[model samples]
Target: MFNLFKDESQSVNSFFLFMQSLANRNLVAEALKVSEAKYRSLLENMGLGVIYLSNAGTVISANQVAGQIMGLPLNNMVGRALTETCSRIVKEDGSVLAHEQHPAMLALRTGKPVENVVMGLFNHAQQDHTWVMSSSVPEFLPGEREPHQVFMTLTDITRRKRVEEESSLASVIVNNTGEGIVVTDQDNKIISVNPAFTILTGFSRQEVLGKRAHCFQSPKNAIKIDEALRNSRKNGNSWQGEIWHRRKNSDDFPCWTTINQVKDATGRTTHHVYVVMDITHLKKDQNRLGFLAYHDPLTKLPNRMLLKDRINHALQNARREGSQVAVLFLDLDRFKIINDTYGHAVGDGLLKEVATRIKNLVRKEDTVSRYAGDEFIVFMEDVSDTKSPATLARKLIETFNIPVEVKGHTLQVTTSVGISLFPRDGDDSDSLIKNADAAMYRAKKEGRNNFQYYRPELTTQAFEKMAVETELRQSIDKRELVLYYQPRVCLKTGNIAGIETLVHWQHPVMGLIPPARFIPVAQESGFILALGEWMVEAACRQMRCWLDERVPVNKIVVNVSAFQLLRSDFLATVERILREHELSPHCLELEINESSLMDNAEHIIKALNGLADAGMDLTIADFGKGYFSLINLKRIPAKKLKIDRSFVSEMLCNSNYEAVIRSVIALGNSLNLQVIAQGIESEAQKDKLIEMGCNLGKGDFYFPPALPDAKNLTKLMS
Candidate 1:
């Protein structure tokens, strides 16, 4: 029994030993799995590409990065021969490299490691050769002479190589070009210059470095170039023009130059490039043009420069003899209208004709010159008084009154002469010309086609005119102009026949300014065009309101200037305005000054006929005033003839004006036109007009001019 128990105990001990050995084997298997997993993770997460290949130069295993570097999938790289990834090895110049020269194959055959061998490999995925700088090392087992595998890494170098090639090409171009080229840093310091610059400027690269490009420019040219540079900054980043440059030998020459500025990514200037072309040989006529500077190129009359010289000479002679020098500044009245209506070619022809006429009108001793556009200055020496200037002025006006024929157009150009005497108006040429110009403006204000002598007060008026003009321009832009309406009553029915529009400037500080104070200035300064257009538009717009309210009004009359009527497109503008407001053309009436009807009779008649044909009413205004011949009344196409306000106001007191009024009333009746009298401020005058067979009248006695306030316009009209 003792021997059996001992055998059983031995059997239990052997079973426990067998279980311990099996547990130890399982732990060893788990450790191996964990180590291999960590190694694979390291290879996948590393930014660098890692690959292991067999000694045959074939892809064995590769990470994602390695496959991406070769522009292929990792699975494709793993099982494929290297022919799929790289077709053949190539040199840096893209020439075929010998198979023996390949680093991977060499290390395998020579039993030596190779490092850093640049190569061009064809990429199957990219379908192009990829330039890569590669370093390869042979891996060998211990005590083995031959390498079993190659450890290779790749870096792309295509972009860098292309940059080097471009730089080389640009260097060759800069050296061989004929035009001089210069580059400057942001500080305007010279940084680089082409060899052509040295050849043209006689300076080497070392001399001009770190210096301003303008340092070697001529003094006169430097000022001009500096100003141009400032303008270029304002306008754009480039400038092209001609400038004088001084070479190292101090020899000056003209050069046509183009400058281009370069800016960085952050909108800051980085550098500037200058291209220069020497133009010294091309300006052969420069000296010839100098001799013709004193004469006007268009009119061939003495220009402003020569006018000044003649004025000085006349003053010198007058001072010695104690005589007066008459400087008549003659301006063509409304010449701009001619230029605008006809083409400039016709206008130029008219100007030459006027210049010839004035030259013929003056004495041989007088210097008649074209002062500026449509202006002529005549400085007559040995003048006794203002009579000489006045006589010449009258003749000039009379001569221009006759129609000038140019380019199939008969233009009646008129003159407004301003006389300024030396030692009276001014002692110098500049002051004399300036004072004459001021007086010329006065003549235009007093109604053009007349002469005026310069007085000290004209200067004050000139300054005030300038102030008014500046403020008036602002008023137009800001829409500060307001409209006023006055009624023209029918004498037969004692009802409102027409409403005339009057413009007022509602000045911020000066209250309301009437048309009388600023109309003349507006007329002279071409602001009348804007004012006239505004008045017509405002009238048509008010008529639209009246229509909305169903007010009892016949027509709204707008006093249109000759300037507006003579516009080539005035008829179209009126038609457009009426169409916009949906108002009938007959609701608007244009009242033009009688003198303007005769001034440009041909053109005015044409424009009026167009308006009349369009179903608009036309009225000849300020009748029997100014130099109006009764013959034009027959051709005027007017529905109404308004008696001159001045003549009507003076009628009861003056017989001559009453006679003139009666004749005008008779003339209207004979021509089948309505006769309207303006400025009837008394019941007596109104009754007298009725007795004289006048149809309509307008004055304070009927209704003083007030704004057509939309809120109460219907009430006021009723």
Candidate 2:
């Protein structure tokens, strides 16, 4: 047993020496086998797929990963042609690649390394394509010029490739969308803008690449939009609303904008996206529709609907202030007659003129609305008393005194105004307007050219005036209006200087009516304009007859109403009348009240200047009563200032009245104007006026106004 152990030990030593000798010469086949096994194990266990191919294109070996990537068994992949195993390989574009273009073949042919060559593999089991990124290296024998085999590494990247493709498509859609899109980073700095953003805002990418999104917002809506964005980000939701945005040119326009937060996997906001669409045209259409609903189409004034709304508001305000609201209902007197005489075109012009006049006379807070067919309603808030409405009514009535010239025809129109006060006549809008309308009918009955308050007793009087208006309308055609003359004796010469022509209504049944009673009715019925023209012609003819009789009168002074003076062709009419009678222009004086001249100062200046230029004398009658500015008085081309009868009649009893008369005379004299006093019924008043440097005087004390005949003129001269 000892000898056997000794032999075994020697054999062991021999084996060790022999292994050592093989190690030293590096020629042990066992060592080569172990190294091959280690390399095989590493290749099989590696995360990457590994394949070994012969230079002839046949697959020599493949690891489990490679077989799995190709959807085949490892043993089945071995010894197979690499090109046949992956015959369905394609480029990223889905086009099939030839065998010679494969990574392994390319590496062998070039004798170099190829990396990251992406290819698609058909998975027969799944019947779908799998994308792989492959890298290959050529293997060469020692001292050989050609590669013997190729080593390839592949990675299954189908999921990553799909994600990249989808991301690229999403980017295209975002860039080309019609709505303006802006993207901002976590810091709220703009990072990207779509093509539509640049187009919509008129800003280029270079101009606003890094600008804050709020930089494009309008000042009016900047704070609102910023708050919305903040709230949206806090809630991790999108905000959508209309906002006003500014363009690069500084124009502000409405836009519908949406802001959305882009969040990460952890639900933390990383970026914000903004989208916008213009809405300017839509807003304009909405506003236009709203305006058209409440406004009148013809005059662009408030219609009945709007008037009612204003009246309600006024009533509310009046109630709060403990003040009164006045509702004035007006109807054009005899408007139909003018319309029938001159056609509807002239009538429309007259109505428009009347509307303008009424608007000019009222306060800014008042509302003047066309009720219907020559009818208008005015609503006044916070009226102090009945005086306010009465004053407004008088001003409105005076507006018709000026003639409205339409297509060469001089038209006169007056309004019969009826007023109803809040809480006094009625409280509500409907009740006030209804009562005011009833009062207006009463005014038409009393006289066509006057105003009346809403009183229970006025209804009967209104019917009576309506009857009188009908009679007055017929009086003009029947030639019942006659001229009466009042002689004016010169205070310095004591000679008849002029005769004032006045209108008298000779109503056949009512007997000889005073000028005040029927004159207003005539003016309201638009008969005043015709009657005025007739008086002018008649006075000129009468003056010529007086001149033929060798009377002492040198001039004929005619009282002109506001209506006659407003006529566009008034100067022409006066000239024609004088020419027809062969009377000199210097012999006719036009007397206009100061209130009438001041009502429309600009237009009146032109008319008065035209009359002065035509060699006719112009006189301002009833001067002190009107609120006339000195500058306007200077603009008026008048030769005479007539002291109002109110001042002259009371001068004897009141020193204040005497002082006013003296001041007026001094003012007229200072301005080189002749002063005349009227209604000097007492010797004391006449003596007081003469002592105040008055230039002319005429009243009942001299002689009562009588018919324009030779005998009355001779008596005035005597």
Candidate 3:
């Protein structure tokens, strides 16, 4: 309390000391000279105008850069209100330039720094010119009543802005193109992908960008694409071609694409662009047209033209390789009798079953074609010797010894085969086919099912088959193709398993069209793959639905043909159907004849193993009918054995057949095989097979072949 006066004196002393310190600042002649020199030097060097405005909004100072930006002299811009010194213009988003809001004015009013705020200045004629990205800074003096100055800096970035805008437009165009477009930088990292690429391939730009272009390749097309890309890069040019690619869904599709490499002036590659167009559908249509031109649509087999081509090619190859090839001409025994009695529908069924058997017996490397209405030609290439051809002929005769079931009837069938060997039987395709055909007639004359080799005198008889193949091609739309199903039964329980699908054809105007009628036609026409796929998908849907209902269902057996089996997408197609219908692999069994397995053993075995691992079962439909060795039979890990029906039908009557059936059963049992006796019509036959320890019997003795939705299926359970 007593020191208050002393404290007031000290405060007064401190204030004078501060004043004296500010007075030492030298804001006089020396300061003026230093500031003027610095200001002039800065103005001359800057490309933009710099301005300083007074607190009252009059220009106090101006630099050469600022004068240039406003298109006015330094003296003219000075002593003028910043707003009046420039003709103000509205900005693009529609904001007006006002004096108080201007950078210099704002700096003066608030005593704070402002940068890159746009303003307008008056030119010589009082017209305003706008300058963008200008800045203002406040200049202050010690002990002053108001801010002494505002300094401004101006720059024109319009050229840079325009370049940026053009670059943005180009980027938009690249991103929106319809063709699948990919851009890679010099380092080969993907820089961009167009919208169409994302849509077609199911990969977003974010997902693929920065990844190398080579990542999209599958092993099937990797080598070709790599070579093409490498070549294109080396030449610094463009290349175009068709390529195979797999989509994100794991489906392989065809694409026509172009690749271009971009290079710099130094001749170094800097970027690459890829344009792709999908061509899967186009290829499919081309294949369809080609198939139609040379194949029979009805049976989906190679017709006479295709057969002749194959035979001619085989002959040429045989001559070049010094190898022997044989042609076996087959004619169905008693095929007309079945057609006359059971109607053409049943006749078609018989023909289809015959085709199935014939397909089963031949090697995959061999070609079996429908020669005519009821005759077939089997071309065996790379035969080890003349004995090989004869052995195959005997196997064909044995194959027909099986019975075909149609409309609840067990019909026994046989085939007459005529054999002709390459280099031994006149060498050329026409002569060999002629000799084989002649030999088949001799077999028919000798007692129908037996075969005879051509002996020069039977040329007229051989010529008869050529006429039949020509007629079969046009017979399908003429109502010549047929459909049939053979009943399969559960081996352990003797319950109806499922039907094994088959097809046949007969011409109304031409009586019975054997498998020789339409199968060769379909195969030649390339319709077989389509037809087989249709059959499998249809059968799968029906049987899978019935099985879903838990109606005492056993696995439905579908046949996979050699053509269908060899397709690249075959597995994917099967998987798609099963997934679509919610069907389990356990509900279906695939019957691949022995011939197909032997022809592509490694791939087929791998495919079968994959299917099996996924829970689908496998069966050999016509056992003891194919050209596989006994060791091959043991090597194939099949789940069931279907005893050919011919043996079951004649077991009681033919002693030789009885012994064969016994041996088959014993061999099957020794291999832990489940044997299903097909064509068990009479009670006597069923008892005989049951006594022989056959696991199950199908045919008239049980229930007739029925649809999966049959109402009376439960009645035959026992």
Candidate achieving the largest lDDT: 2
| lDDT string, candidate 3, 306-402, tens digits | 9889888887887888988888989886465455445678777777777777788888988878777777888888989778878878888887676
Candidate number with greatest TM-score: 1
| Number of the candidate with higher lDDT, 2 or 3 | 2
lDDT of 1 at 401: 73
Q: TM-scores, in order shown? A: 0.58, 0.45, 0.36
lDDT of every predicted structure (CA atoms) = 0.83, 0.84, 0.73
Angstrom error of the Cα, residue 1, model 3: value is 99
Candidate 3 stretches with Cα past 4 Å from truth are 1-486, 490-493, 504-517, 548-550, 706-718
Taking all chains together, the TM-score of candidate 1 against the true structure is: 0.58
Model 2 TM-score relative to the real fold: 0.45
Lowest lDDT sum, 10 consecutive residues, model 2, at 334-343
Ranking by TM-score: 1, 2, 3
Candidate that beats the other on lDDT, 1 or 3, i.e. the better one: 1
